[model samples]
Target: MKNSSAADSVVLGPRPQYPIESVDNALRILLLLGERSELRLTEVAEYLGVASSTAHRLLAMLHYRGFIRQDRRSKAYVPGTALTGVAFSILQQFDVRQTLRPFLEELRDETGETVHVATLDGTTVRFIDAIESPRAVRVASRLGRSMPANCTSTGKAMLASLSTERLHQLYPEEELPGLTEHSIRSRAALEREIAGIRRRGYATSSEESEEGVSSVSVAFPAEHSALRLSFNTAMPVSRVKRADIKRIAELMRSTVDRAAALLH
Candidate 1:
């Protein structure tokens, strides 16, 4: 028994004891990259509060794996095409568009608005599929477009799924970007908002992304994949009242559930 205990301790020593802090820092770096097109090594190091050498090491590793890249002439780092490629592969690998087409069409039919399927790409949301309404006044989102997480209902739905510990780790206690007057600016306030979203089971945005447009979103928990899928319907503010938003949430949740089932 003594020998066995000693052997077990050696094996478990390699296991992570401080996963939260490390992951939190890693996520912060990713979030910063999402808001900007590119960053230099010194800029990333300053942002992470690490030594320049340490940050360069981390950046180099990410670049090596195709998660990030640096412009040769500008010497600035940008989110690599690897992420976009992975996003494409994810949709194709799961054949999500083919499986979810019926549900998306149904959502557009019921809401008379533009419906979209989006996935979390790092701290941004990327639209995988979209169906536009027949009305000329309806809002529309382009496929493959990536938007800031703090600025969209679909992004908020995914953010709502993370734990408070995880959320703080993502935003940190320092400066959080505000793209519009309605964007979440403080980590604490955002945490409360995220908690409320978890309780309510859906997310909403009113002109956070763009003025005169509103959206509501829900997430789908598919069995086979660890990643959650989310969908949203964008409409003109004139056409999207509080009750109408609620109805859209209901329709989106139902459709997402069906899509998740088929996706799995």
Candidate 2:
């Protein structure tokens, strides 16, 4: 009779019967690689409770399939281009509208104004989602519309989050185009406004993008990778008084913080 070692006697509790053992082991390796930046064969073998030779064979298969690559210097496994494509594809399937609409709706309801989620597009800000105010006299919904990033509250908020070098790259010229007289004209002027936004933790546009609309916006923290986004509440200048901007800005900040938490 052969004597069993502690390793051989150790039992893993119940697992699904339908999964193929080899495929399951390979997937487990893939998941482990996803969590870690790099993995050595010895580490993989220890992690999976398998022989070094078995782990090497699994890694070789993954490398051949383009899901993993070996570092020439370290001989450790890292995610490959194929894995990046898989991750991007999975991210593309995430519905931003579905995830953010409830927050926009809640903001609109609370503020009694139009709420917008805008993302930067070149020198412009595109409105990706909106919830219109219930009041008949509210600012018109700008969903599907694009406006200059230098002029809109949401745009300025996102712009303020960018680095100075990036800002210069985006606006090489001295002057930026304006939709209204209120719109920022010079890069220097825009920079100053952005400085204020950074200090205040939010931005405001007083008829800058449109004749009658005024808005207050706050940029989402830099953690969101899918888009550089901001949340704004727009109202007719008649409805949103000067004193109201402070209250609305605070509300926008709180709502954006909650939305950012949900995203993570």
Which residue pairs collide, candidate 2? none
C-alpha lDDT (0 to 100) for residue 104 of candidate 2 = 88
Q: After aligning candidate 1 to the native by TM-score, how far in Å is the CA of 260 from where it should be?
A: 1.2
Q: What Cα-based lDDT does every candidate model obtain?
A: 0.73, 0.82
**Candidate 1 per-residue C-alpha lDDT over 1-264 given as tens digits, one digit per residue, 9 for 90 to 100:** 011212123233354776675454555566666545467778767766778897887787778878787765457776676855775686756667777788888988898889898877646788888988899888876577888776788888988876564455456555567668887767776667677778878999888887888888897763434455788888888887788877778777777766776666
Shift of residue 83 alpha carbon in model 2, Å: 18
* Top candidate (TM-score): 1
Candidate 1 colliding pairs, count: 0
> How much does each candidate deviate from the true structure in C-alpha RMSD?
10.6, 10.2
Q: Runs in model 2 with CA error above 4 Å?
A: 1-93
Clash count (model 2, backbone only): 0
RMSD of 2: 10.2
TM-score attained by model 2: 0.65
